[model samples]
Target: MRKRFLVLILLSLPLGSFSQDINFELDFSAVYWAPKSNDTIRISVGNNGRYIFTDSEEVAKSFGSITRRFQPAGGKENADLKLLFDLKTIFMLMEVKIGQNTVLANVDLNQFMKKGKSIDSATVRKMSATPTALKIENNGKKYKLYGVAPDNKPDDLIYMAFNEKYPVDYDTYFSKLMTSATGELFSIDIPSGLLVHVEDSKGEIILELLSIKKKKQKGSANIQLKLE
Candidate 1:
């Protein structure tokens, strides 16, 4: 049997002062080969300030639902949804049903790679060992976020080192980080029956035993996001 994959890309505009809320719409398609047949999948991602929704259609069945939220390593909230075939792979179809409208799309995994050639192995290792840190100034307060050894303390010098590696205006970098984090929260879903330990930059686990519950006939799950 051939494996299937789906990828959804959601983009949000830069935040600015406004009464109206910001939302996102995304759609994509993909074709795959199974042992007995070729199949196609469609996916969509939507956010209307308050909540994020993802819808997928595979063959003909539809899956639509709200996402699960997680507290990241910086005391920030994150959300995600996943359809898995096993321990290592995710399913490729999703769908959303609004009051009177439905949105859909498919994912082409190969298309994601088309954006650029592969990175070198050494570069990949370096990135994994040291994810770029971001210093954000929101509402006149500055905060730093990054990955580090599980035992190290978070401080200003850490922020400065990250700043030197990625040279950009702090505000601009902060905005991008917020947008990216929001997108990840919308798409990735935490699995049930597993323990997800969320932490702060100081390596302190703040949230544990997050639960996922599926809404009745809704094709989605609601999460009881709790912090310790």
Candidate 2:
């Protein structure tokens, strides 16, 4: 999945008047039971609003909970969850803009394992690195999300969507987030775990809600949103 959705309501009160940073975490567990083997994929949110999407295949037989903590990459302010979690960009880009098309907040994720070639001279390697960034001039009316490959390599078009501008409201969003009619894109908006399930010849994948934790800051917010 190259692209992805938006806000899961960090605040109950409308965000039009208030501007501050808040941290939230959405936990989910995925599993597939094939008679021969079991597979699992897990996804979660970060305190700074990064979504961690990881995929694992063929486990021995344990479904114990796991939280994979990763330190920020060297010289990189925000750790690439795409790299740390399952080594693929399995999450999509999401955002919430407030007054005057100003981006209030955003979340991002994508599909893993879409590799780009690397030239080391000594050896060639297959590496997948797509940095997600989305921009909208008219505040969610229309969006263009692009996946920029690291090291000035090739880039991929994640998602370009259109919607008539609607005034901000809880009902206006949060029921369902859709990127494209086809399920090529993936998005993780909390509680939306309700609508997330996958089944194919390889068994089934489920997102089970575990917990949600949130904290708000009163002063200036240093929210490092991924999308523009």
Candidate 3:
């Protein structure tokens, strides 16, 4: 009877744990700046009490070209196959604020690399951005704004300020914004010589711009294109 009772308890434990709902919300925001050209990118993500996924919006304007890539938690390469964003540089810059304390993360892209790429320990440490007020140029006008935040209030305010400073069609902007936000493996091929900004909800920011110059040889093209 004692052994039978113990089995019943053990079987019930899994059910009890599964019965409890684990609900969580994650809010992310980011701003990318180009010091030399003076351009900025601003974005925000709101996860509605579901820790599994979130919704995002991005607004970008620049003189040249910019490429944006999105990757979720288990490395960019491990993203769901159905998602449409490029998995090449699986890097993300993410911040999580559970309450008052915030945890900043910079997911390293090298971890997602398949086999032989050299891994730099220093690169792993370089992902967090210090919180600060930043000056940015949007649509040929200058605006001072805070770096990234974990709340939508500040981001909404900045959006309003941007509209006031430079008049543009918000509807068209929003349409493009939605496209960029939905695709899991999408990449924007920006023209060269243009300043760009990137914001991500997943606390991993892999700045591919700096690493863009290295041209891959023909032999390595296969590995780079392998989506899985």
Highest TM-score among the candidates is held by which one? 1
- Prediction 2 TM-score vs. true: 0.21
Q: What are the runs in model 2 whose C-alpha is more than 4 Å off?
A: 1-22, 27-39, 44-176, 179-228
- TM-scores of the candidates are 0.25, 0.21, 0.18
Ranking by TM-score: 1, 2, 3
Q: Tens digit of lDDT per residue, candidate 2, span 87-149?
A: 122223223221222222222221112221222243222212232354333322333322312
1 versus 3: better TM-score goes to: 1
The better candidate by TM-score, 2 or 3, is 2
Worst 10 residues of 3 by lDDT: 216-225
Which parts of model 3 are misplaced by more than 4 Å? 1-22, 27-228
Q: Candidate 1 — worst ten consecutive residues by lDDT sum? A: 185-194
| Candidate 1, residue 209: lDDT | 21
Candidate 3 lDDT tens digits, 1-228: 111011112111111111112222224333544444544433322231111121122222220121112222343231111011112223233333222222223333233222223322221111112333554444465543224321222342211122221122322222233232332222222111212233343422322122111111111001011124
Model 3 earns a TM-score of 0.18
